[model samples]
Target: MATTSESEPTTVETPGSDDQSREGEIFDLLSNQRRRYAIHYCKREDDPVTLGELAEHVAAWELDKEVAAITSAERKRVYTSLQQTHLPTLERADMIEFDDRTIELTDEAAELDVYLDVVPADSIPWGTYYLGLAAVGSVVMAGLWLEIVPTEAVPELGWATLVFALFAVSAVVHVVQNRRMRLGEMERPP
Candidate 1:
């Protein structure tokens, strides 16, 4: 019979590169997607919620409540009561003097924050960049029509007519550009 060493599990700790004293393992209490959802719900939350309310929210999202009900969730729910709810309260007291760079977060929220950023700011409309370019193109076409191209010299055509002509040409170019963009083609036409 092989005897197992019962000292304890070796926890992974981060390097103490900074002055803050959070050198030990950062608790990934909110790492679980369900727990994260609950925490996010709490972040938006006006006040601290009871465990029962959080459990209800997590349970509601369960497509297979029968499966998650037995092990991961039921046990996890109690664990979450400690991990997601109580531990956070405890960790609130475990604060290192905020030196600005030192982070105090679970392994999950820290990882997530890398991607999602910590700020609760609203999202930018990326489409606005395209719309803005289109507006600039219109303005440039107008300038070319009014200033660069002399219409009367081309016979009967006025500046307005020149603007319309340039706009027509630009429309073709715009459509082609849009088509290429939709197809994810970046090569310029030769």
Candidate 2:
């Protein structure tokens, strides 16, 4: 006869539970402005910049290659972030090769850098721009659609003007609704 014997517990440990660190792995891959700058600095350097120099360089950071000067404390954070956080995580993914002296992106990482690599400072999604255009189009289209002047009746100037004004009001409503849709504020009722 088959019998129920025992059940093992499922223990979820925050650390040392798995061979990988998910949070670290992700942060390594999705580099922000500062992290990318660190990588760029390493790639461009002919020699290893000391932690102090790196720290200094990071402080006066204006995203300029020809920066004026570096500060003392900024160098420390740069070095620590580069070492404990950036270098090890990148090394695991083969994004960069690290030795005692320095760290740099691997040939593969550099080559693959062309795709989904870094977010440019000025980059803006085209969807937002197109949506703004759509708002303007809705207004113009609504105006033309109203057709205040009926060819059959040939209404008097005052009546036609009043109708045109009403049409213009409708156009304004169209523009407002379009704006809401573009912003994802339109709700579907259940």
**In model 1, where is the ten-residue run with the lowest total lDDT?**
181-190
Query: Which candidate has the highest lDDT of all?
Result: 2
lDDT of 2 by residue, 56-160 (tens): 455446334333444445556666776777667667777677774466556655533333322224744334544655666565455445764354554455554
- lDDT per model vs. reference: 0.43, 0.51
Model 1 scores what on Cα lDDT? 0.43
Q: TM-score, each model?
A: 0.29, 0.43
> Candidate 2 vs. truth: CA RMSD?
13.8
Off by over 4 Å in 1: 1-32, 62-190
Candidate 1 clashing pairs?
Answer: none
Off by over 4 Å in 2: 1-28, 31-33, 42-55, 62-68, 107-125, 141-190
Candidate 1 lDDT by residue in tens digits, 1-190: 5455788666555676442343223234333455444444343343455555445444544433432344555645654564545445534634211122222333333233222222112533334544665676677567655675454466334544655665677668656644443211222110
